[model samples]
Target: KYQRAATCLTKDREALLAFYDFPADHWDHLRTSNPIESVFVTVRHRTVRTKGALSQKTARLMVYKLVQAAAKGWRRLKGANQLPMVTEGVKFTDGVIDAKNRAA
Candidate 1:
C-alpha cells in the first residue's frame, strides 16, 4: 500500500541526508524553511489585501520596506561561526567534522 512513498524516499535518500555534511550548530538552520520565505509572507499578505492598486514602483518599494522591517526582528543563525568552515569545504559527518574525512 505504501510502496510508492517508500520508493520515493529511497530514491532521494542521499539528497535528503546531505544536510549531515554541515556543522552540528548549522543543522537547525538547514532543517528549517527558508528564512526569506517568512519575510515574503508579510509582503504577500499586504499586497493581496491591497489588490492590484499598487503601481509597479510602489509595489517594489513596499516589498523592499517590508523586507527591511522584517529583517529587524530576524534571529541570527545558530552557528554563524561555522559558516567559514563550511565555505572552506570542511566535511562533516552526522554534524561534526569527521577526523577521517577532514578537508585537504
Candidate 2:
C-alpha cells in the first residue's frame, strides 16, 4: 500500500504543485472539496428524500435554484483584482507575484 501511495504521489507531483499558484488566503479553499461537497449535499438530500418522482424539468429547476442560492453567499476570491494579470500570463511564485512580473 505504501509503495502504491508513494508511486502515485511521485507521478502527480506537478499537479500537486499547481495549488501553490493560488494566494495563501485561498489555500484552504483549494486544498479541500468541502465547499463543493456542501453545495451538492443540498441537492443530494433533496433528491434522495423526495417522496414523489420529479419530472425532468422539475429536478433541473430545483438544482438550478439551489446552486444559484448557494452562489449568493460566496465571497470574492482573494487577490481577485489580479485575476486579469493572471489571465495575461503573469507569474506568481509561492503565492506572491514574481519580482519580474510585478507592476510598477
Top-scoring candidate (TM-score)? 1
Task: Identify the runs in model 1 with alpha carbons over 4 angstroms from their true place.
Answer: 1-10, 100-104
Write one digit per residue (lDDT tens) for candidate 1, span 21-73.
88889877877786868987988998888885558898888888989988999
Q: Name model 2 segments beyond 4 Å from true.
A: 1-12
Candidate 1 has an lDDT of: 0.85
* Candidate 2 local lDDT, 1-104, one digit each (tens): 59999999999998989877766666766777877888898778877888644688988888899888888877667766877876887777888888887764
lDDT score, candidate 2, position 77: 76
TM-score of 2: 0.72
Tell me the TM-score of each prediction against the true structure.
0.77, 0.72
What is the total number of backbone clashes in candidate 2?
A: 0
* Error of model 2, residue 91, in angstroms: 0.8
